[model samples]
Target: MAAAKEGRKAPSRKSAAEEQLPGIEDARTAFAPALSGALERPRSMLRALRFRPPQLLHLEGGEAADRVALALWWAALLNCDDPEVMEPRASAMGPCLSCSSCLRLGVNMHPDLILLDGREGSIKIDDVRGLRSILGEKPHFSRWRVIIAAEAQALGIEAANSLLKVLEDPCPDTCFVFTAPQRERLLPTLVSRGWVVTLPWPEAGRPLAEELRPWEQALGRFVSEGRGWLDMTAARNGMDAAKAHQILLIGQKALADCLAGREGGMLAAVFRRMPAQALMQVDELFVECQDQLQAQVSPLLVLDSMAARLHILARR
Candidate 1:
């Protein structure tokens, strides 16, 4: 993506027509419960700002769209002029959607809200430098300047390091928010600098597939019945990187479902028998496999490696 132009307001990546379309407003109602739950930490931090507040906030584990919406909601709350009017019980409960700050943020026009979107392309070093320049100035219209880097996993290494420098010595009254499929997708050093808020996986949008049954059953047996059931050769044959990644995701969802106590599936039944720590290890393995895939590792090698490691876990 191109670097944001220098000014109080970084030029919006969205076209005028796209900005006019309903976004965070619709997301607020559609994802009310999830948004409310995710906002609790940031809300508390905002209430205790006299103490050290996290300069960087990582919103992880949700649909990318939902993460962005939650970030926007948090931004609104931070800048809202009348949060007390909407949330009478607690002044910091949430944003008053009608406040001037909230209104501009709702439509992505807030000058203090700078968005460095990496969804369409890699966020480059120039983008981070441009953002640094803008952040050097004070908030143009609100108590806080919020920078939302949506799909931050797409930030190139150089750009991520550049942003990391900003995070290390963050501008006063500035907050940096990052949204990603998982915090593991970001550099560990970068993730360490932020406060991570994990959003629940949206129930209706969790990836599902009828074709996943066979794979799920296979995984269940491999875990339940031991290494004899794992056929790495067969698993690797004819599989491409995309399909391998899908299988890992499917496995992850099953493990997550089992942990959440959502019942009645083959994988869930098998996963439920394992200790919670073992289940977590399996999930971490899936993430590691995904990282390898993203690094252009061969699908066969990744699958075979995953199978061997899973078999060792199954034995435990």
Candidate 2:
């Protein structure tokens, strides 16, 4: 299930197209050479879609949301019953997003679209165990099965090895797509199995408070003041930790960028107001909170603890 149904009501949803990063529009141009060669052969359109591209496709760069949106778009394209709506609409149409098949993809409920996320920031061995059985069956609706691993770098040692086994002997009708901050961060074994496409984060330059959602800006203020504002309301509002995690990572990166004398991202000023030691401690605490949540800690309790911890971190 997507974050919404996981009882962690996500703050907002960014559809695949809405999440496109800087170079997404020029997508085919980047893959033009390979696409040209692939199209040179006069194969049936269905055959081309199902069996043409390499089974493994890695989407590199951009924020996690951007990558996810891209992955979803790719998955939708692969399974769209009507290929006429694709790339070259006149030549190859993209998915009619309104169709039943496409709708399922939008909702993250397509039987053939398997979404594997790192529950607590790590993709453990058990997470990969079910892939085998899921792949064993034929796709329930679409012509091809698509498996998207949102944060491929989060795969643990054993999980990566397990994934490698399947890659070594992949199911013919399935496509494996991975999204990550950097391709180099992935296991070499995984990297060697596929080509990579890099998507840099969208050009970022905004005040930290402005970069975040209005609520996040408010949260930042509360954090800066060593106050508790997100204790109960976040859960009531269905906040998704993944989104928070992204912000935390961005904030940390901003701090690093500031340190290196580079123009930092939106949250740079926020970090500027924070002490280095306190920021480090807060970062570590967030990781711990995520891990505990994965370990079945009560959501309310976990959040309360986070609020208390943030208050202390801010005080320092």
Candidate 3:
């Protein structure tokens, strides 16, 4: 969901019987009144409210552009007990509200919906270790557990590998909902373990901006031409996706440094601490890099090509 608008009033909870009487049965009746308060009052009232359960909805965007609308439709069901489906309105932004709204909505302190982010913009191995520490404990509040990773592709190799273990063998109550512009950019092993859903682009027409033209053109061709690497790389940049492919090249070089025992401080550390499976993936990266070089593909383009081929190669 897009970030919340600044200065919006907090949701109210004057009618939140859930706060007055906390229980599953009461919680069901309270949603309507609380929803009314949400519409009537400022956003702050939600914090005064009580607990709510966690819900995970995986949505994918197709070329049609209405994915955001479709996802929001599903989000409405999160608060409601009814199983009936409802049409989504474009106005409701999925949980991307300000911290203030989160507080008001009884959602700010959800132990189940854990929000994980990188300490310094890059997810490190420590991040995964931190999650591992909490893996076994039952959720303190919500029924379902969710882990949202923004910029999921920025996960460092060690971090990603560590997460793979959990993904392969998730706790019974856990649900992971990851968002990325292009799923193909993610590690194939990781992608394969989860339900892959696409969010179609918005249905509304977009004006062709000058800066976006190149990206639009490139993406269009990549998709139509089955240029997997080019498409994946261009999408990663939130534009052309070339940056991830470029970073993969850097990873390849780093792996070569490790295999050769060049004795660099960082390389030596990676060789020491990285798990065997992760090391093997790094080794495979070099082989792919060699192939990319032979094809005269730039380092920045190697990531997509490798990711694309992995669909076939990954099976082996």
Query: For model 3, how does the per-residue alpha-carbon lDDT over 123-187 read when each residue is reduced to its tens digit?
Result: 56787788876768754433334565544555666777888877665464455555444565456
TM-scores of the models, in the order given: 0.57, 0.57, 0.39
Model 1 — which ten-residue stretch has the worst lDDT?
Answer: 1-10
Global Cα lDDT for candidate 3: 0.42
Which stretches of candidate 1 lie above 4 Å from their native place? 1-52, 83-92, 201-289, 292-316
lDDT of 1 by residue, 163-192 (tens): 888877747778888988788888999899
Predict model 2's lDDT versus the native. Answer: 0.59
The order of the candidates by TM-score, greatest first, is 1, 2, 3
Give candidate 1's whole-model lDDT.
0.69
Score residue 110 of candidate 1 by CA lDDT: 74
Best by lDDT: 1
Considering summed lDDT, which 10 consecutive residues are worst modelled in model 3? 41-50
